[model samples]
Target chain A: MSVTDELLANNAEYAASFTGPLPLPPAKHVAVLACMDARLNVYGVLGLEEGDAHVIRNAGGVVTEDEIRSLAISQRLLGTTEIILIHHTDCGMLTFTDDEFRTSIRRDTGVKPAWSSEAFPDVEDDVRQSLARIRTSPFIPHRDSVRGFVFDVATGKLNEVR
Target chain B: MSVTDELLANNAEYAASFTGPLPLPPAKHVAVLACMDARLNVYGVLGLEEGDAHVIRNAGGVVTEDEIRSLAISQRLLGTTEIILIHHTDCGMLTFTDDEFRTSIRRDTGVKPAWSSEAFPDVEDDVRQSLARIRTSPFIPHRDSVRGFVFDVATGKLNEVR
Candidate 1:
């Protein structure tokens, strides 16, 4: 079976004991934007249960127009007020640069992507960049509690970036 | 204390027992794009552990340019092959129209967003839409195993969107 099939089988087991249909709005009124790193389980890291917070993630956990869009909807429509941003050590985005990645894609696909690859040399700097993007975006109304962090891979500890 | 602080305390407990520093690439060779809904716990639902799959999420779980960017990096740089698109039942995206959302934002912020809100009336249709977005993208290398599903909030089951 494909790994997808294996996960589907796992889902059957998950559904058997599940009782949900939680309230529409997050009980904690928070949203988290984190990297799409396979190792960083946002729910576990935050001790989140169902109906707790809106979890938004991407390649570098970097803020793009899309992330701002997600955060605007999350805060405006869903009532989440606080925001948390997470980037982690040993991320794939750190391995390459925007120019090299785009050029490689261009050579392979014959159509170069116009978008920025959003790769970063430093994780904390990017986390601060994400925080700044959210703060500067006029779309997101709640900015008081916006914070950023870098998750240590080996220790699994989140260190806040001031 | 803020909810962010409470979550930070939780992170401490998570760190206490955490044993990680897993390999950077996903072990299961799949990427899951799902809604950022608070109730849909992608890890628990899929029985995924750390390092299993790349979980990418947004407000609607809809594919846009950023998703295309992320998928290109995932396939080209990280080696994930299969794609899973998940849109859950009773998602916040269905509660408002794009025009309504943009108009409300314009009223509040004095500026309108150029991006689409990506709201849809039907969950399965949006799942299909997300699937199509990935299938048609020339940037994403693998499309053969791309699948979409609507996760049932009440039953905790993922119903395939065929």
Candidate 2:
């Protein structure tokens, strides 16, 4: 079976005991933007249960335009106010650059993507950058309620960037 | 204390028993793109452990340029092959349109967002559209391994979106 099939099977088991119909707005009125790294459990680490917060993740947790778009919707449409930007140590983003990755993909697949990978050298710096992006965005409603952190993959500790 | 501060406190408790240095490459060779809704536990539903799979999330799990950028990296740099596009029921994205939201945000914050909210009325159709985007993107490798599903928030069940 494909991995999707396996996950579907797993979901069947989970759904057997499922308790849901949670409210549309998160209970805590918070939104988390974090790296897509499999090691970081954004909810478990943050002590958030189901229906507590919205978790938006991508390659380095960088606050790109798309992230801002989501945040705007979260704040304006769904009532989420606070924003947390979480990057992590040992991120795959730290291992490569946009130009280098673009070159590699072009070489392998003969396609040069117009979008940047948004890689960074330091996780903390990247977190700070993301924080600034949210704080400065005119579309985000709760700019003053933003925070940033770098999660250590080895220890699972989150170091505040500010 | 702020919600973020509470999360930081929880992180401290979690870090006390932290496991170390999971490999950068996902062990399952898979990636899941899902909605940022708080009710859906992407990892738990998929039975994914730490370092098992890359999970990319956004407002609606819609495939955008940035999502493609992240997926390209997941496939090209980190050895992930399969992709799963999962959208869920009761999504806030079902509530509004690009023009309506843009107008609302403009009236509230006096700034019109240049990006689309990527909202849709039907979650299953949105999942199919995301799957098609991934399949058609030249930047994404292993497009044939892509699948789509609509996760039922109340039931915790995933209905395949053929």
Whole-model lDDT values for every prediction: 0.94, 0.87
Q: Which ranges of candidate 1 are over 4 A from the true structure?
A: none
- TM-score leader: 1
Kindly list the per-residue Cα lDDT of model 1 for residues A24-89, writing each as its tens digit. Answer: 899999999999999999999999998999999999999999999999999898899999999999
Docking model 2 quality class: high
Please give the DockQ score of every candidate, comma-separated: 0.91, 0.82
Error of 1 at A124 (Å): 0.9
The worst-scoring run of ten residues by lDDT in candidate 2 chain B lies at B108-117
Residue pairs in clash, model 1: none
Q: Per-residue alpha-carbon lDDT of model 2 for A20-126, expressed as tens digits?
A: 87888999999999999989888778988889999999999999999999898888878887888888888888888889999888898787878787988878778
Give the DockQ-based CAPRI class for model 1.
Answer: high
